[model samples]
Target: MSDFTQQPQNQHGSHQPYPGPYGGAPAPQPQPVRNGLGTAALVLGVIGALAGVIPLLFWVAGVLGVLALILGLSGRGRAKRGEAANKGVATAGAVLGLVAMILSVVGAVIVFKAASDVVEEVDKALDSASTAPKDPSTAESGAPAAEETPDGKPLAAGDASVYDDDLQVSVSAPKPVEAGEYAIGHTEGNKVYEVSIVVENGGKKAFASDSLAVSARAGAEGATAEEIFDGDTYGKGFTGTVLPGKKATVKYAFDAPADAKTLTVEVTPGFDYNPTQWELTL
Candidate 1:
């Protein structure tokens, strides 16, 4: 018999090799599920939704929302095809992106409407100011000449001062009056005079009589005259409203130096009106 070596053999009688300690060629590792797109979509959707509530950020939110929606849809398709994991995450990202886009549109609309309204109101106010009449006395130059009466002279008693609005104010000639022994605002050496002031509202709107003001100066020295209060016939000033085409009259007493020959009275209809003066012989 020829010399022979024993070897492991297969059932078919062919030589066979022994298996290695390490497992058969390591089973190909399953490729890591590609979920990057899904994750990115979710992140962008969350950011877009957060910004959507702010009206000023509507543009940013709209852009992010569109990107999220596109990426999420692609990711979901990949998940369906077994290319990516996190199918639920991809779907939620798409829904959130849609919500963010809707909010952005609403916010943008509100912002636009508010801006338009503000612009319109500003335009109306400008128009009204431009069309309103201006008073020469209140002009930029502020010249004393602009404040002079139309006739360039102080009005005489019983003369009416007509305003730009057609309202008229007049004062009656001063008449001597006796002060009650106990009356208020009387100076021992002063003479008392009573005068009537009349305000006529010729404009379409009612005139506010309460806003009327009257003051007087006595003699060439220009001393301020004191107003007298005698319960019976003096001290009541202008009051109530004067309707269109109506008149309001009030009587007032002033105390002046006994030798005063003239009383210069000034009348103002309202805060907006220019003061007008009258010269009254006392």
Candidate 2:
């Protein structure tokens, strides 16, 4: 018998030694797969949706929602193909993204509407004040003035006047006050004139304070006058909300040339095109 004897070879009775079954090297392990896009989409969608309620953040919310939608769809596709996890979360994210986008659009529309309303109010105020003669010179330009109506009679100091829907107005005569202890002096070669006015709102709506304006013209038979105060500034003119069926008294100070003779004071109630003028002899 040889030192290395063959194992039992029964069937073929071959003289070759029987070799054990050959085995190859162990196979490489697969890398652990990870997909986080689904979670990312879900988080962004939720945050964007919440932010949509804020007026200032609505625009940002819209952008984030769109991004979430894209990512969520991609994540959902991956989940369906078994390439990623969190399929339910991805679906929820997509839905939330759509809702956030819609809400954002609605919010933007509301903001624009509010802004439009404000602009309209401003327009109305401006229209109310448009009755003033643009070129104070028009009254003295050698052109014939409009025939003054009873309600539109020119006012002077201390005249009881009524105009535009029964609004009662009165102004004290313009008195010259030299800059002294009780008064501030007018600019060089100018005279300070003070007028006290009482306005009664007979209309149904509350008076818009912004609609009040005062303009002065040269009192001379042919001289022109320009606006000295528009009631735009506080303290110097009338300002504040006047409720319906209310009355307010305001004092006005005007500076004019010392020689301005015939002074006309025009009072305008807010939002009405027609204005009432009072003629006063200095």
Candidate 3:
């Protein structure tokens, strides 16, 4: 038999096995070094594109992209002289970061414009309904308005005043809503909670003026309530506008921390006013 196929005896003892496939050592891998500025550019770029994210991140991304591009171009020359570096990664980081930066600026401008439009719409509504009567604040007599429902409150009988009642806001689902389809949505890693509406007026004069002030229930109160936006309600394209004699539709879509089966929308008149709540499906 030829020696190539035969097992050989080791020095002074047992048989030795032949080496398997290409000698046994693992193949070498490309080492990954930290691409400093490149990494920063990439991170900033990702953050900048996020809607509802802090606007400053976009600026940071643009700045970092510039830095990465400069360093990468210069470093490419150094690498040929024996410096270990990642030219491709740095280039990509710079490009993506710039894109994020540009988009963020555009997004901000759009938001500003939308806000202006909202103000105008409110003014128009108020002017058109200027003849409608205004109601007293909840502080005036601690009473519910005629448009309000008990929802579960005891009312003292006397002269019936609609201003003494709590408003009825119900949130019903057309079925279960999947996430991300609504404005007030429920998704992981999102920043808002419990979107709702407030009817400044009801009946034909409920929206006494088109100049309405509508804002989300933000910060502390919302946090303490742990209320979240309903996927179903959000999907319906819920939006609120003060239309005298017409129903005011307030819509909210945001991301929340967990899954919920019940969500509520609270309506409050502008300024220090007693608010009302309407429930929605989670």
Candidate 4:
């Protein structure tokens, strides 16, 4: 009978028979596999997200993170191919990438808001300082030159003497007054009025005791009053001295009438300042 179990032998004088069901030769072995792409995507995504290096490029990193996450969710099917990477890393990358994208948008908004505030503040300062004598020539000659805007336009009521960048005072008008509007800088409705001034020490350094005093006049003839540096003025009034970086918010109101046509506000916002003082008119 034909020998079913006995297969042909090797020709090189070997004892092993040809590979077959009965030949006893080693069975064919599958090739080793790897999941290198998934691991790499996860790592790149995580690094991008944490570093915030390319916030504007979130789409790229986020996409990578998602792709890695998908592969990881597959139960590490390719790990059997020999790429001994972890599945958790892919998920973390996805989470971080998404977070980075959201934070980037928030950060952008904050930056824009800060920039706009600074610009508005500077404009107000320039406008208020408009009346300031610019031509050392004319000012020395005692001729009242026309006020100019930052870019040299006719000064507007929005003019302010204090710039937020140079100084930031959280002023409280004791009585409700427009903080930064046309009606600001005056107590009277028509612009003529007495305005009590108060500057709050809202920074991180010692400011001079006189830094909080402010004065206002109606058409150069309005009544003016200072927050008395009395015992009652501490902490919340002009009376107390500001400590290094401590707060000294002053509160006081002035007589603002509805019939006046013009008013001017003045103050010195710093410790070393006894600056000719700043003025804003409305």
Candidate 5:
């Protein structure tokens, strides 16, 4: 035998290296755990994109797309250096995220445009309805002749003063005061007067009566007098909806100064109807 003993060899036919200080070959370094953020970003991006189709959820898609892009870049770097195992998946996630974001924006714009168009159409329909005229037969169904008199007559009491040729408007003389019953009662230094005005929808279309109003004054150039007080529920002076071929009668009352000798009444048709005036000597 030779002076030294033979040592065992590895498969490469070289002698085995000596063991580490305290153990067999040093434990292999553990690999860094694969970052799952890339996968998470991919999932979120898909979900966000779907929700983003709804106009209100577009913001969510943008956030997910950005996150996916960041994770994909990081994962690609790791993969190039042999640190991560899933480079292809990360890239796919990033690309999908970008596509979803673009789709979200486009979808939101389309939905908004459609809604706006619908609203515009509805507005047009309403405008036409409001401006259209009613049929002639309906509007002039019970037309009265125009009456012009210095002293007005009672309308409901069948003594009307003026009736328009087309019967679109009728004005009656001041009704006699029935102080204890229908008239404004117990004025110390004032006289109460009531009048009736009738408006017929002479046009084919229905119209709102928002523009009708009545007023009384001491004389042609006198100060406007106060309207007689009526409870909210009892007062319907010159305010209501009148349909095509329909008729509306408005009752108006005012208190004049006791010594006033002349009173003037003004009936203004709302919505561009010509105003009518009458002078009555008290």
Candidate 6:
């Protein structure tokens, strides 16, 4: 009788160790919950919040705020789901993102309102320009209309040149005179003439006669005639002021070439009045 104590033998079976407590491959370490989304959300939220205060950057702030809000919410959800470990950080990021969004909305409103006001002002200015009356003296070419005068001819002696609808200036016909032997501005071969300038003031304001000016040209060559100052016979320009409704007159002498056929005299009432001309046959 063979000993029947035969060890349990299996067909090509290898001996396996008995499982022990805490032996299974040391439960795979859960990868550290990546907090990348939460960190990114925090950073973006901070930037967006800072940009939200500037009016010109309102649009940029709005775009960044939207992105931050979406990212923050996503990160918060990830944290809540236990996919990320930074739950507090994610919540803070979401709060900041919400604040940034609110500020961006306010900034956008301010920017839009300012732009609207500027546009309205521009429109009003354009309307005013369009409705304003055109100046009657301005021609279609934007130049002042030509003034009608005595056919571009100088006024005759004794004819008044009206100014400001109140003042009248007239020049008398030239009277030939013999120059004194030692007269100041007379050439030996030239002739001298005396003329009178009369100014009638019809307006309420006194005319400043001290600023009056007189000049003369001789012959067809338009040579400047020399003024002759001979004792008290000829005075220098005008003096003082002409009272309203009064008349002022001054006599002047001019020396011209011996054979000059004509004399042209110009009278300026004052610095304010345009100079008027008178033509005289010599």
Error of 2 at 108 (Å): 1.7
- On the 0 to 100 scale, the lDDT of residue 65 in model 3 is 44
Q: Which candidate is the best by TM-score?
A: 1
The lDDT of model 1 is 0.81
Tell me, by lDDT, which candidate is best.
1
Every model's TM-score? 0.55, 0.45, 0.29, 0.32, 0.44, 0.47
Q: Model 1 over residues 1-282: C-alpha lDDT tens digits?
A: 649767779999999876788877766777668998888889989999999999889988899899889989999999999889899888888877887898899889989999999999998666434432233333333111233344545777776776756677778899999998778989998999999988877668887888788899999998999989988678789888899878888998999999999999988887667787888898
Instruction: Sort the predicted structures by TM-score, highest score first.
Output: 1, 6, 2, 5, 4, 3
Sequence-dependent TM-score of model 2: 0.45
- Per-residue CA lDDT of model 4 for 1-282, tens digit only, reads 876676555787566845565756698986544545456646655664654445455455445545545555442544544444554554554555455556556555666777899999998667556423232122212222223445333223322232322233322222323322332233334322223433433335555665444654544556553222223322243554666435444444334445434444455554434332223344
- Expressed as tens digits, the lDDT of each residue in 55-173 for candidate 5 is 66767777777777777777777777777788887777778678668867876787788889999989866754454222222333245643333333312222222222232555566
Judge candidate 3 at residue 282 and give its lDDT: 42
Q: Cα miss at 56, model 6 (Å)?
A: 31
User: How far off is residue 75 in model 4, in Å?
Assistant: 10
Candidate 1 clashes between residue pairs 3 or more apart in a chain or in different chains: none
lDDT of each: 0.81, 0.66, 0.43, 0.44, 0.62, 0.77
Which runs in model 6 stand beyond 4 Å of their true positions?
Answer: 1-151
Please, what are the lDDT tens digits per residue for candidate 2 over residues 1-282?
Answer: 689755776678865666668966799885543467778788989998998988667897899799889888988998888777788888888888887898789889988888999999999777555534222222322222333344334645555444434445667777654444334423566666766777665556666666677776654653444323433321366677667568788866666667877677777665464566777677
For lDDT, candidate 4 versus 6, the one ahead is 6
| Order of quality (lDDT) | 1, 6, 2, 5, 4, 3
Clash count in backbone of candidate 4: 16
Off by over 4 Å in 3: 1-34, 50-84, 131-282
